[model samples]
Target: MLSMPLRLRPGDDLRGAIEAVLREHGAAFVLQGIGSLSVARLRFAGRPQPDVLAGDLEILTLAGSVSPDGAHLHMAVADAAGRVSGGHVAPGCIVRTTAELLVALLPGHVFAREHDSGTGYPELSIRPVPQASAS
Candidate 1:
């Protein structure tokens, strides 16, 4: 596994920035670490409007996987009031100072998202990446 560290600057959409990295590498990666966000736009499962959280919010937990197809990230953040809220990471989550991230890449596998008839959601479909020919 290769570890990648990223620092997202202000005005960057959280999810979009990360997904850019995944596409840049042209592979799948596992996102792991604790980060901070000045503003959070989280979409709760089944909720119409996203919970727009602002201020110095501590990202308590962040976990997800990014594939060539898309990203599936879940995060929990605590506000200044100590109230914690989280949901599927969405766009418009602008960063404040910065957002630190750690991602791990697995060389052997490729990940893709496909529509699942049962869950009615796009789910990850993991496959073995073909080995490249020797130079």
Candidate 2:
């Protein structure tokens, strides 16, 4: 396991930024830390359009696993008014001030998303990573 601390600058796309890191490793990883954002684009369950929240917002919680192929993350945030909102994380969430994050890399595990008949949505599938043979 490896811990990665990330700080996203202003105007950076939140989800897209994280996706870049996932693509960098192209492996299993999870976000595990608190962060703050000035802007956010969150999509509620079954909602067509994501709500674009503006102004300082405290990142209360972020939970999900990611792979280079895709990511499934949920987030909750508290606005400047202290009104809390949460939903499925989506792209186009531009950062305002900054976004501090701690990403954990699971080198021994592999993650992927596949269309599931039961869920009727792309769901995350996790498994152990294959061992590499000696050269």
Candidate 3:
């Protein structure tokens, strides 16, 4: 396992940045994240669409798994008034100031997303990396 500390700058897409890391590492899990965001788009529980929160928002918590296919992240944020809201992290969550994240990279493993008939959504699939044979 490789632990990576990442810092995201302003105007960066939260999900996109994590996805980039996943693309490089193959499989990684976001242990935690703390930062500020100018815009947060989150899909509440059982909601088909994401609610957009515009303004200065503090990232209370962020964690999830990211695979080569995609990422499943959950985040909680507090508004300037201290109102807290959390849900499934979606795209377009723009960083306002900075984002600090600790990611754990899993070697010798591969993560894929497959369609789950029961859930009607794509889910994570874990498998060991195939061993390479010497000629």
Q: Tell me, by TM-score, which candidate is best.
A: 3
Clashing pairs in 2: none
TM-score of each: 0.86, 0.87, 0.96
Q: List, residue by residue over 20-128, the lDDT tens digit for candidate 2.
A: 8777564545565467777778999889888888888888887677887877778899988899999988887777777787888887877778899997988877778
Error of 2 at 111 (Å): 1.0
Least accurate 10 contiguous residues by lDDT in model 2: 24-33
Residue 11's lDDT in candidate 2: 83
Q: How accurate is candidate 3 locally (lDDT)?
A: 0.95
User: Model 1: residues >4 Å from true position, as ranges?
Assistant: 132-135
Tell me the alpha-carbon RMSD of every candidate.
Answer: 2.1, 1.9, 0.9
C-alpha displacement of 118 in model 2, angstroms? 0.4
Q: What's the CA error at residue 54 for candidate 3, in Å? A: 0.7
**What digit string (tens of lDDT, one per residue) describes model 3 on residues 1-135?**
999999999999999988986776678999999999999999999999999999999999999999988899999999999999999999999999999999999997899899999999999999998999999
What digit string (tens of lDDT, one per residue) describes model 1 on residues 1-135? 788887888778888888887765545555665667888989998987787888888778777888887788888988889999989887777777677888888768888889999989799888887888999
Could you arrange the candidates by TM-score from highest to lowest?
Answer: 3, 2, 1
